[model samples]
Target: MFEPHGPKRLSDIVTGDETWFLFFIIPPKRLNRMWVDGQGDRHVVLRPGFQSRKTMFTVFFNYSGPLVVDILPQDTTMTATYYVQSVLSQVKSVINEQRQKVSTSRTLYLHDIAGPHKARATTQSLWELGIQVLPHPAYSPRLGTM
Candidate 1:
């Protein structure tokens, strides 16, 4: 389902046209933590804890009714190049089919992040599909997969 940032127009959510959206959820485990000992007479130490482990997922929020693809990896290993390539192929096929159905153009908004797979083939494939990749700024959490 779609929701506008400022206003909720019925037409926005139920556009009745083919709109392809790629939803990516990347849960990055905060790599590591470091600490320094302060000069104190037997001081107690404290450190912040990370609550969740790193995981990535993708969802196709097809705006042409309830079309969803819950495709995800079964393994819990680190992200690999093959996995990204597979996802790219799947997404490209979906977009092409969706565009054909409603007789209209398509748009894509990719979340900005750096990784071996994301930086490689995924970017090039989207561009070949005439998809617009969103620009990402350095050290910016505000514009992220929330």
Candidate 2:
């Protein structure tokens, strides 16, 4: 697809990626250990509570570094509508802020081929924002081997 543009400059393209973070942290095992003279006196340690609790963040940037990060609300599932309305719109702000470094009119939007990213509404929203979505291989990282 980039063939039309020929050899491209890093400054001309921007990529967006999303990741999740868990607020809860597990203290180092050594820190949890207590040096007691007797084995029965040793202290016991427990794992973190609510390990599944986490927040998802979408990062948008180019070679210059991160431009924007959107954090999803706790327990919210990312859907197509939510992605376009909340995350996709933020790309505009990133472009506006980095207009001098990036293209003033348009930039390439690279994201995984997830259902939300490929939705018609999302594609349309990107088009309206002067962004062109770069094709990406579809992979479900959540899957497990048979």
Top candidate on lDDT is 2
Clash count, one per candidate = 0, 0
lDDT: worst 10-residue window of model 1: 10-19
lDDT of 2: 0.74
Provide the global lDDT of candidate 1 against the true structure: 0.45
TM-score of each model, in listed order = 0.42, 0.68
**Deviation of model 1 at 30, angstroms:** 39
Local error of candidate 2 at 79, Å?
Answer: 1.2
Query: Which predicted model would earn the best TM-score?
Result: 2
Looking at model 1, the pairs that clash are none
Candidate 1, residues 1-146, lDDT tens digits: the string is: 23556433222221111223344444344433335568645434232342433334554444555333433444543243544565555655665575566321245444446463356566666567565554554775776865
Each candidate's lDDT (Cα)? 0.45, 0.74
lDDT of 2 by residue, 1-146 (tens): 34666755456677787788867766666666666775466655676442646789988888888877999887688889989888867777767766856554457778877788888998888777777666775576755552
